[model samples]
Target: MADITAPELKQRLQAGETPTIIDVRETWENEESRIDGSQNIPLGSLPDKLDELEELKDQEIIVHCKSGGRSASAKAFLTQQGFTNVRNLLGGMQGYQQS
Candidate 1:
């Protein structure tokens, strides 16, 4: 899976490169704060929620969680599920907030 840094992602978004951003953090985490426009799908529910992401299979998907662990797992799972353009937001939202 591809790995993208927070600054790179920010630049891409600023440049109008609107990739699908998936937030794999839990509901509580999402309630606390999240990147605008990111789709929230907690890591635990992803397997059952595959259909929700079907349309994104062929697109550039950026997965992220509180840090990077959950997103890494999500990236592997998406790859196994045949998503070719999956990527993990390196350091996740925490890194983005820091930046």
Candidate 2:
């Protein structure tokens, strides 16, 4: 699937669509700023979170990071692990803030 642009995501959120959103930045980065309602699961810890996220395997999941790099990796990893609808937020938080 194509990655979601920050402006597109902002519109969805404004429309009240509640897709499962994950922030793949570090704990401190997440604390500094985040999309409301997004779950914080640092990229380094995603392997350990498989069990907790198993039930959401088929659900749409949006992942973002400081500058899109980490979240892209997260999306790739999740897709490989059988998460059918994982998408990386393009440009990540930096883009989101600009949007």
Candidate 3:
């Protein structure tokens, strides 16, 4: 899976382009902090949640978790599911915070 650094993602979002951003963190972790406009779908539930994101399969989808691990998994899963443009958020929210 390709990676989008926090800073790069930040810039795209700030420009107001609507990239599909999925947050794969737990509910509690997301409740604490998250990138605005990202959808919350825990990593464990992603397989079941694909239907909800079908419209995004052909679009650029950015998956993120606390520090990139879960997002990387999500990216691979999405790609296998026929999502051609899935990208993992590098360093996840931790890197976003630093950026």
Candidate 4:
């Protein structure tokens, strides 16, 4: 997967599709606000948390950061780790806030 827009992702969530939403922001950033049901894992700790995501490797994953940059990196890292269905949330939470 390439990237998913906030509206599209929100629709998918409302429809109950269980794609894992990974928030690759720092703890303070996450505490400020985050997508409901998203997993909080800072970008730097992603490598250490790889095992935590093992079972989700086969599932679709939607990653987001404050403004999309970190999420893009997260997407690349996940792809390298053999996650077949990973997507970066375009525009990240800022986009979500808009709609």
- lDDT per residue for candidate 4 within 54-95, as digits (tens), equals 999989899999899999999999999999999999999999
TM-score of 2: 0.97
How does each model score on TM-score?
0.94, 0.97, 0.95, 0.94
Better of 2 and 4 by lDDT: 2
Error of 1 at 87 (Å): 0.6
Q: Residue 60 of candidate 4: its Cα lDDT?
A: 87
Please give the TM-score that candidate 4 achieves against the real structure. Answer: 0.94
Local accuracy of candidate 1 as per-residue lDDT tens digits, 1-99 = 569999999998889887899999999999999888898999999999999888888889999998899999999999899888998999898899998
Look at candidate 1 and give me any clashing residue pairs.
none
lDDT of 2 by residue, 1-99 (tens): 778999999999999999899999999999999999999999999999999999999988999999999999999999999899888999999999998
- The list of candidate 1 runs beyond 4 A from truth reads none
lDDT of each: 0.91, 0.95, 0.91, 0.92
Candidate 1, overall lDDT? 0.91
Each prediction's total of clashing residue pairs, residues at least 3 apart in sequence or on different chains, is: 0, 0, 0, 0
Q: Which lDDT tens digits does candidate 3 get at residues 1-99? A: 468998899899899978888999999999999889989999999999989888887889999999999989999999999998998999999999999
Comparing 2 and 3 on TM-score, the stronger one: 2
